[model samples]
Target: MKNYFLEISFLLFLLTFSSLKAQTYARNGMVVSDNKLASDAGVQILKRGGNAIDATVATAFALAVTHPAAGNIGGGGFLVYLPENGQATTIDFREKAPLASSPTMFLDENGKLVPGSNHDSIKAIGVPGTVAGMFLAHKKYGKLPWSDLLSPAIQLAKTGFPLTWALYNEGNYHYTNNSTEFLKNYFIKDDGSMTSFGEVWKQPELAKTLEWIAKKGQDGFYKGKIASQIDAFMKANGGLITTQDLAKYQAVERAPIHGTFNGYDIYSMPPPSSGGVTMTAMLNFIEQANAEEIPFNSTAYTHLMIEAMRRGYADRAEYLGDPDFNLEMPLNLLTSKDHAIARFKNFDKNKASVSDSTSFGHPYDGENTTHFSVVDREGNAVSVTYTLEQSYGSGLGDPELGFIFNNEMGDFNAVPGETKSNGQIGTDPNLIAPEKRMLSSMNPTIVAKDGQPVLVMGSPGGRTIINTVFQAVLNTILYDMPVDESIEAMKIHHQWLPDVTYYERNKMSPDTVRALEAMGHEMIPVGQLGRLMGIQFFPKDGVYFGASDSSSPDGAAVGY
Candidate 1:
């Protein structure tokens, strides 16, 4: 048994090292994404006379088949697009609460929260928007046929693809605990064994679904046989969705939040996604603090950035939410230079701010998600982030559909306005309502210089996503590092709740950690922080640089 364990350990090490050996480089057109197969699919689109938007559509569909844990059609996400000569815009396809859903749906007879009921059940599923989102984007900016864009993914799903060791291990780790019966049925064989690495994995059902959608577009998924399957499943399992809910779902077109930091113009998803507002606020605070004066990754710089992030998160919890539901968000105040200066003035360089001491207006507040970036030679760029909310969300995937649904319903505050056992407010701007979209932290962003895109980036770590993207932007603009080093740098996150600061283990030096501790931070070390996908373009030189987080084994930055 000891020798067997040793052999497995050695093989895993070799696999990790081999994956790491693939390095970052520059190219003319590129796609950087969490899954290598998805990146290849996007590159193939670019090679076949497709533009950036076309490539992004292809990549997203391919990810649905290759990285099923997070990439999903049953889930929803945000997309930020920048055309060479056109204005930037965002597509909001975030999952919405069913019309029948109420604020108290997750509560019990006692009006108290029922812990696991919100996450691991059929009722947790929200009406998905990925198909609508993809179709709309393609309609507006796609240079290739919709059928052509989906062909790669359909082929990969129908024909078998080799399972990597990382995927095999992740499947076993997530499913073998008997946490979800459906997940076990999908990954585990009847012979009492789990699927092994290098096995040929096929999803013919998913292929058929994609083919139907390819022919009929969004209507195919939302109003046809696919919708019937979802409705049937919900009816049999005490779920809230109806055929009406699926048919009523529409992808919204929102104006991207615009900001300027260090001579670069930034565009990201607007409200309903607090990420853009919060991240922009942090950048404003950092710029106000003259953060460029400090050495990159130094203890002083880290301390300052952490403080800014702390305040940004606080603001997010207190004020940001779905604009349609809560129309009174402090948009002008939160993103203003004056507000940022005022917020930074409260920070004490030598000490961390206590959670209780923070005030409102004054203020405010992880699982499975994926991000991808693409850039075409025409200078069009796309940065997108999507998710299932958690690994195998709801664990209630339709076996016939060959896709997993999102437990985004769990994202809502079940007991709004109530104080938690941990001493934090339950909800305000993000309270649940019928058919309202939950607040999300997925920030797909693009940075431009005088109307020319310079950086396209985003990440997946639930709440930690905003901070990861914030730090990476700082590394590139303030520290003058390439995209690779910017993504690979150590990260620290403070969400202004529970009063605990979490830092990635070994990413920070011991002395830096000790200094932060001395400053009154209740620091906790974590193994990893986020998985970011980014591409940096130099319009003057016509060069493109791609970066994928090394922490994710399947991630790759492919270019041509």
Candidate 2:
């Protein structure tokens, strides 16, 4: 009788586990982002019959309220949108250098790059494009009312949201870090103490700004009172942006870069985002190498990947930049399979590729960034990576407006041909210039299998964004891991100039690190390479599975 009872209990446990696993399916819609409130806001839009674009707009705005460190309204980013029945496209609202900026803006009198000068000053601010970008995207594809999409964020700001441990940590860091300014203004109390976790944090001023935008549309922020306020602020703070710059800002719509890898089509943002071109080059190089024979995450496979990354980044430094400025960017040749093969031919699998030694054919010549993905019931999808370039960006807050502006100026080549501390040579194509967009690594990507959207993914880690997306795609396609497991897996990054292979601390075994080092690779164990968010679709099963990287402690993947 005891044995019979034990068998029945075991059977019940198995059934319960199976039922829980089956619940991963989402036939209606999915929203995966690095913040729970933001994901819930997007999901709310989907529940209200909003399309993917609407949900994305809603999510982006909500992120500004919930994840202020990177998700921002004062910054700029790129987006890739896939309609239910049309070709995928990208929107480039990347921040442009101020009209008053010059090529040597960040250089000192001695012609040396000033340490932290570009990042910690008001001059670091660019002519912001987040408002313009979202407005244009919504005007083109959003299904819900524009005001409706922004209401959630406005309401949250007016009322308040509980501070999560992640936010609390950010506030604590600002209190201690002398470089931080705006964060203290918003998160610190009158008594000079930081807001603790779970405390209600409100942004009445930000709410006012959102309310103005909701009522007046694009002109509300870009042309009227807001623009005048920004101009005044800039003049007072030594920033170069003017009311004319704000009024003239426009988000450009561009074709998404489409490439094929392992029988799957990958769609990503194009320049002034270097992400698409870089990711395409890496994928093509891997394809040319016949990398399928190697096991995923093994030492051999990791080495091959590092070499591929090195080659891609080398090409990036030499060729890529703002297409509007550098008309000679070799987009076709860069993305061509033939070019990839030619580039990979010189790679030696036995040893590390020296950054300065390899000579490539003359061709072209390309921070903190945030990403989120949304897929609605009608099969429409949107993947966006936006940012203010650093944690709390520029550290210069708009006191009256209550938000921080991006320090994207830090991304440009302060001086052409300057060698950075990391040993990478700055290229002329990306040199600072008036009205030129700074180069970016924000890659918002989508994967479709057999003409059906299967994966919507992207990440935030500046240069690490490309490789993180590459590994995640391979995780789902090659390893066939579940979406959650795939995002949870360890990630490693190598930018040719850095010459150091950074592996996620505690994720790679000591044996793997030793093996990589034995191959003449400099192995540096780092914490949390990138915070990725993804939604994987199983067409046959009529379900969607979403995953948020555990590194983002408060991230959420909501579906219905």
Candidate 3:
């Protein structure tokens, strides 16, 4: 295994790369997040002798309060935990469709989609699983008391934290420009204006909600008064969630999806999330084709990467979904190296492959999510990525509950059997079903060398998540890039249906763009890709280093 400790020594290394950007370094534990306060809170948990699992549970809850745009208890996601002395495992907390939901729920009388019903309305919310997921992680692996892990978030919500310019800017823009009345109510002051930057923004109701969980654990939110209130609110607002759905919601602890990438063990959340298998397949394609020999930023290299992404995404739409719902899913085949090589038989190396249809069963997630990575002194690592489906979720919040509801129901294939060229997937495996967890692209992952977890990584960009994470692993382990560069490196995404390869604007040379376009690939540009949080550990001295995404204005990598 390569020792990054020697590769980027300026901050966390004993050697130096060429003018590498600054990175946060530490001798023992580290926490990385897009929210500084959330990172600090996780580091505090580490300082208090908590394990990586404890710190991550704390960090996720803290983000729920501090970064409402994505961090959420009103939403759900996946968590991967790697212990120094124990087996690696994952918690699948991807949200479930309400019991009343159906394959045709989003369709109108004419069988067309009910306009805005999938995301813009009350029916979009799923039975939330964040609280249950965190609870189970703590119950099985947490070192600190469950209540202690929640204290930081509770305090931040109750006592208030200074609103950052990013939040203020984004929130105010929506508040003013959005036509929805509910959108205008977010982050409002008593005078009916949007909260300003640098002002203390408090959510006392959210604090109370946290207090309930702290006192009674997951039941605090999924049952009793909170569940009753949610049911009542749903009834009043024409939402689909019921108290039964809340009571029946259970965050499952499933075996980690395991793959070998160039001798490193890649462990991640399994089905219900297409991330791990898809990413591993992409890695397999790259390794099988020996594409690493090509220059990293050249058009040829980008073409190969985009083809791999297209195939992986294409297979995802056809073969993957909630494992419990699709018992026949070819999990082993999809993640195998052989399957990857089989996929590349059509690769021309010089051309971009068509992405209209996948090789398997059929065809086709959100870009609004948050991820954080935690590493404790004992060598334990935790990677978590969660989301509410969109910015401000459903654009609906309860003053009484003090949290936005996730529109995650939209994640399920809403229009069955109607795959579209515009990126709308209607694959059967992902069609909405009662009590089924929607398929996700949230791939929180850990890379272990010689059975020791060395890297904990994940990102949030909906469908872009899998590609970003796939590259992060390949960047660090295969290309041997420094931790910061692994995260900040220019990235591209190509989910199958859209048939458009998106490159981060200004990051790609115009010549490179034209060169890629010459390969029959339709290329577009986006302002950014996924916002990643990552950590690399060097066991020689038990040192830990963190790299937060540069895209987040308030993000940081905190360590001690």
Candidate 4:
């Protein structure tokens, strides 16, 4: 009887693990985000007959209340929308420098970076773009009322939700590390102390704020009461943003960057975001090399990937920037097939290329972020990756407004022509300038076949975001990896500087690590690289399969 019980327990464990690896399938709609509650909020919209764009808007708002670590109204990011019928487009609501900002805003008199000024101070905050982006997206593509779409999030804020282990840690971080009097307000804990696991967290102030947006739409935040409050807050503090900055912020609708890889059509965000251009270039290189024949994570395969990343990121640092600011950007030349092939032609598969000193080709190029993907019954897909720069952002929240401000100014190259070996770039393209949007790695992408989206996905990993999204595309289209495996696969990151390939600890075999190091490449081990959320469409069965990366303890893929 004891042996029989042991056998049953073993079988149960196997079944549980298998189920976790399997996709969550649905017939009409699917929403996948880093937080289960946020995914449920998206599905809630779909249940009310909302389309993909509407569902995504709901999800983004819900994340603002649930995933406080990254999801934010005080931050900004990119959005890629692939409607079933209309032309594919992207919304660039990325945060911009305030009018009072300058190139040397974060520098001292001696031209050195001010300690913690760029990332942890009021000076680091930019004009937020998330609310503007969401409103613009819904204004163009939404079927449901804007207020109705935000109902779920407002409800979550008004009542409360159980605190998860992940949120507990984040709140503790904010509660402990909060420095100034302005930043001392707790994340969601009204009692001013971190909550225990499973404790309910309610934000009455946030509910009132959402109610304003619900009633007045975009004007609710940027024009009237909220704007006045922000102006007053900044005046009381030392922040650069003012009522004029908030009132003038607008999200631009741009044509999506389109590319083809392995017969799969790809649509992604354009300039200011290095994602699409760099990812397309790297994908083009991998395709030209016929990398499919090489074993995954093998020494040759790893070398090929690193070389592609090296060249792509080098170009990114030199050329890409906000299109409105930088007119000389050679976006076409950088993403062209010829450019990719030339960049890869001299590659030696057995040897890794040096990435220490990066120089740009005549053609040119270009943070924490969160991503959620939504697909409705109509075949429309929306991919969004938004963030507050660093987790919890500036850690400063006005108790009355109840939202954290983003420190996105740190994304800028604080010093000119001062690139470093520790992954800091001081290139001209990304230099700080007033009213300019900072360049980003946030690339929300969709892959379609025969003009129908088959994959909707993206990730958040600061500099590693592009590479992580790049592999997700390759894993699905090139490798035929399962939906879950495509996101859960071992990932590596290589930016042009630092020249080190950072791998997830213990994810790769020791033999492969040694082989890679023998190829004259520096390798370092780190913790998890990204938390990816994605959905795979199987048109033959009229089914959608959603998968959230296991790295997010509370993450779930909700479908119906």
* Native-structure RMSD, model 3: 5.5
Candidate 1, 1-560: lDDT as tens digits: 37988899999999986566455555558999888999999999999999999999999999999998888899999999999989999999999999888888888999887877767777878889899999999998899999999999999988968888888987787666766666776655446577689887777888999999989999999998999998998888898888899999999989998888999998999988888898899999998777878887678887887788778877887888789888888888998889998998888988887765234321111378999999987889999999889876777877788788899877776677774424234566766787888888888999999898989989999878888898888788777877887888888888777667788898888898899889888779999888888888766678898888888789999999
Best by lDDT: 3
lDDT, candidate 1, at 42: 96
Tens digit per residue, CA lDDT, model 2, 1-560? 37998899999999965543332457899888888899999999999989999999999999999988788889999989988777999999999888899988888899887887777788999888898899999999998899999999999998988888888887888777765566666787656678789988888899999999999988998888988998998998788999888888899999999999989999998888888888889999988767778877788888889998888877877888889999999988888899898988888787777766233211111145678999999899899999999877787777788778998888887766655536435677788888889888788999998777899999998878888888888788767888777777888888776678899888888988898888899999887878888989988888888878767777888899
lDDT of 4 by residue, 338-363 (tens): 99889977888878887664453111
TM-score for predicted model 1 compared with the true structure: 0.94
Winner by TM-score between candidate 2 and candidate 1? 1
* Per-model TM against the reference: 0.94, 0.93, 0.94, 0.96
Best by TM-score: 4
* CA lDDT, every model vs. true structure: 0.84, 0.84, 0.87, 0.86
- Looking at model 1, which ten-residue stretch has the lowest summed lDDT? 357-366
**Candidates by lDDT, descending order:** 3, 4, 1, 2
lDDT by residue for model 3 over 41-153, one digit each (tens)?
99999999998888988999999999988999999999999998779999999899999999999898999999889988889898899999999999999989999999999
Runs in model 4 with CA error above 4 Å? Answer: 1-16, 19-22, 176-184, 187-193, 358-367
| Model 2 local distance difference test score | 0.84
User: Where in model 2 is the C-alpha error above 4 Å?
Assistant: 1-24, 176-181, 189-193, 357-367
Residue pairs in steric clash, candidate 3? 9-13, 9-15, 317-363, 317-364, 318-362, 366-462, 367-461, 367-462
Who is ahead in TM-score, 2 or 4? 4
Model 3 scores a TM of 0.94
